[model samples]
Target: MEDGFNIGDIVLSKMGRDSGRHYIVVSTDENYVFICDGDYHKVAKPKKKKMKHVEATGSRSEYVAGKIAEEAKTTNTELRRAIAEFEGTENVPVQQDEM
Candidate 1:
């Protein structure tokens, strides 16, 4: 965790095709981490990216972290909610365009 990143931590893709997109860290090992947005990169198949390619958001989902710590399976819905909440965009109200 010295790198300020851990499983379930929120991160931003700093490089590559997914650059600028936010994702959750699903797993990590040495210099690489597996991440997912719960949409394109589902939990079943996360993107393996180098640690340097991501920037930690200093936020984490305890529920996701706990589940992963226990080696439990997580669903896309749960992950999506966690990320939305982390980014403070959960339950966003739909805006109507003025005529």
Candidate 2:
């Protein structure tokens, strides 16, 4: 967590293509913060010193909770698939290579 922003805090970007864009704080270093917007592909590491350009818009506790729930669902599904494979009832799911 940074001195000014906590992880999972929602914020609005004030500059760049992400200007006025809403994002959730994911991490912070001494001077920069990592954020994830609705678009996971749009994650950023912006400088805290320049954070004046950003505004704390809201809290992402609920959003985080939703993400946790989604992850749990995926994990459960994977476990079930694995069990099915072990029981010889289904083929194992393929693991795709990362691009």
Candidate 3:
């Protein structure tokens, strides 16, 4: 199986408070990737997590990939919508700040 992660790729968190959550890879380096779920981690502020901490789901979002490729502005709404579409859900509500 192709286990590599790329921009716009959906992943499942294997660790942390967000464990078992799905997120999109927004950025990456050799050892880490920045991920956002639109709910917990907004696209504007992705969370940098270790690559080993996430498991690649082998699914990708073309919309998110295009946005990342073009460096276009992304909002939480868009992220939520994309994720919801990928998950076959009606809609994904924005997460409230827990502070």
User: Largest lDDT belongs to which candidate?
Assistant: 1
Q: Could you tell me the lDDT of residue 42 within candidate 3?
A: 78
lDDT of 3 by residue, 25-81 (tens): 899888899999877787767999999999988789888889889999877776777
lDDT of 1 by residue, 1-99 (tens): 336688889999999989998999988888899998887788888999999999988888999999989988787777888888987888964232222
Q: Each candidate's TM vs. the true structure? A: 0.85, 0.49, 0.85
State the lDDT at 46 in candidate 3. 93
User: Which runs in model 2 stand beyond 4 Å of their true positions?
Assistant: 40-50, 62-99
In lDDT terms, how accurate is model 3? 0.82
User: Would you give me the overall lDDT of model 1?
Assistant: 0.84
Question: Cα deviation of 42 in candidate 3 (Å)?
Answer: 1.1
Off by over 4 Å in 1: 92-99
Model 3 misplacement above 4 A: 1-3, 91-99
Clash-forming residue pairs, model 3: none
Q: How many pairs of residues collide in each model?
A: 0, 0, 0
Evaluate residue 47 in candidate 3 and report its C-alpha lDDT on the 0 to 100 scale: 99
